[model samples]
Target: MKLFECQNCGQPLYFENTVCESCGHRLGYIPDMNTVSALEPEGDQWRALASSGQLYRFCQNAELDACNWLIPSDHTETHCAACRHNRTIPNLADAENMARYRKLEMAKHHLFYTMIKLKLPLKNRIDDPQGGLAFDFLSDQVDANGNVTTVLTGHDEGLITINVAEADDAEREKRRTQMGEPYRTLLGHFRHEIGHYFWDKIVRDCGEEALEKCRAVFGDEREDYGQALQRHYNTGAPPDWQNNFVSTYATAHPWEDFAETWAHYLHIVDTLETARSFGIKVRPRIKLGHELEAQVDFDPHKANNIDELIENWLPLTYAVNALNRSMGQPDFYPFILSPAVIAKLGYMHELTH
Candidate 1:
């Protein structure tokens, strides 16, 4: 994430900030500009400080202490861009639910940020003809209400259901260990689930020719998803899977492989952007987009055709891993991208432009 500043006082601000500490200015993110700015009171609502002509209202959920985004009060859609996608939210009165919901909201915001940056269309189920891009932050077995049971995070159609338990550190860690996965987080879950949403909306429904190319790279997605998931749990992933798959789950089906690769692409691009913002040099005179495209040329000893991104990412991940060790925490990034994975990433990069 990029560092934000208070427009009034030039004080450093975080993405989640509602009020600037130094200047006490009210802040709201402008999705159209991908910026956070101070807001000035305008009659019953607020106006962007940069341009008083543009008006916005703090999301109603924000007033209820559940959101931090802004919306045009007179607009037909009442919910803010991020909040509109919520299909189910836990009982707000419940304290545990409030905490978990907050974490889920944070992850959701990040997902929206990335999606907007990629220029992807984001329509909620309510607005779409086929119920695309919906979310369900649900209470599960871990937080059982003497009724419904939840096992894991998953995607159905365009609806992404995330178990609220994943927001709890201990609960999430237990599941992480149980699954033998190196890395797992709320943001990662959002990215992975959205991958499924995009795959259906963009790739599958694009055209038959595009679908054929998608199958060529990710494999035919005609396999019965439920059966594949059941077999994966019963027999586990095949041996020598690491040679071809990005994650064990990816081996379950072609749809999963695409989702896993899509999530990894988001991870790589976001981390590389963070590195760039921090003035951490990776490749000389090479831009981020160019460097990312060049990562397909895998040189074991050095990042040859790849620009500063992969070059900088290698050392950055190592340093982060070492830092986590020093703090007795797990490695931040716990997956390796093989040559085949790099090629997949290249394809994703190609799709972006």
Candidate 2:
């Protein structure tokens, strides 16, 4: 979520940009460098203008315009670090599926940006046979009458499955409303499910002490997941659910609580980084309390403590929500981070840090 620019031309580039319009330079993101740079044509490989004489090739997914990452010329892999994690993609022959897959890729790349920035371990399936990450972007199964059947978005072992239909705003909003969700998006789906994967990687394998600590914060994971979820659906969350859980659904199970908290932690950190990129400092005009003021001069990703992170994050979320309200739009962040939620988030911060 950090800011990016075309290294050759000093032109700002969005996360999804593949070209620098100001300089007519081909652009590609280098994950290792965490940069977008201009490229020059070499005899058989392209040389990155940022790193002279180093030959690189666009990721293979560039053929579909689904990626803008570059691979070192001598690298055996054709796909970039991010693309290699994908185990399956939707059927591109279907126009609708292709459109959805593109959206999925955009969100996935953004997710990878955060993971890389956080310096998290990202092993592909081939790298770690028992504990590795992969993704499967799939479309819903449709009946003869065109009704979508069993398409689930979840994480198992290490594979994160996403329903490509989440890309469609209408469909996504429909589901969100039906489920009484406060917020939902393709990127949110990725972050939430990937939380499950990390729970496996970090908590399950870390040791008994770490696992026991997690249980203390979230709840006992010994509950029957299927039955707990079914009961949760049949009977909604308790009236006091928000007192402890980050969201209503988090009350369903210990796993859901951890995943929801993890997703929110990612959301806050990544969005706070974007605010820092623009040198946004919030100082309310009114003689409001100092709590309304925040300056983001330091790297949020490296925030040494949860207090520092939350200090920057709260004011930024408040400022953005204010801006949205001025435009007659809903609050940018509708959920409240209660003290209990903050404690849970602190645990997550500690775990990742």
Best by TM-score: 2
TM-score of each predicted structure versus truth: 0.87, 0.97
**Highest lDDT, which number?**
2
User: How do the residues 1-353 of candidate 1 rate in per-residue lDDT, one tens digit apiece?
Assistant: 66677778888777788898887888988777777889888789898875557788877678666677887666866778999898888877889989888889988898787787877879888779485688888775534556656646788888888988899989988988999887889899999999998888788778998798888888889889889889999998999787788899888889899999899878876766655555553233345544423222221212232333455566667666767999999888887777787777666766654
lDDT, candidate 2, at 305: 78
Candidate 1: residue 151 Cα off by (Å): 5.9
Candidate 1: list runs displaced more than 4 Å. Answer: 141-148, 282-309
**Please, what are the lDDT tens digits per residue for candidate 2 over residues 122-210?**
99998986779999988778789988786799999999989888999999999999999989999999999999988988998899998
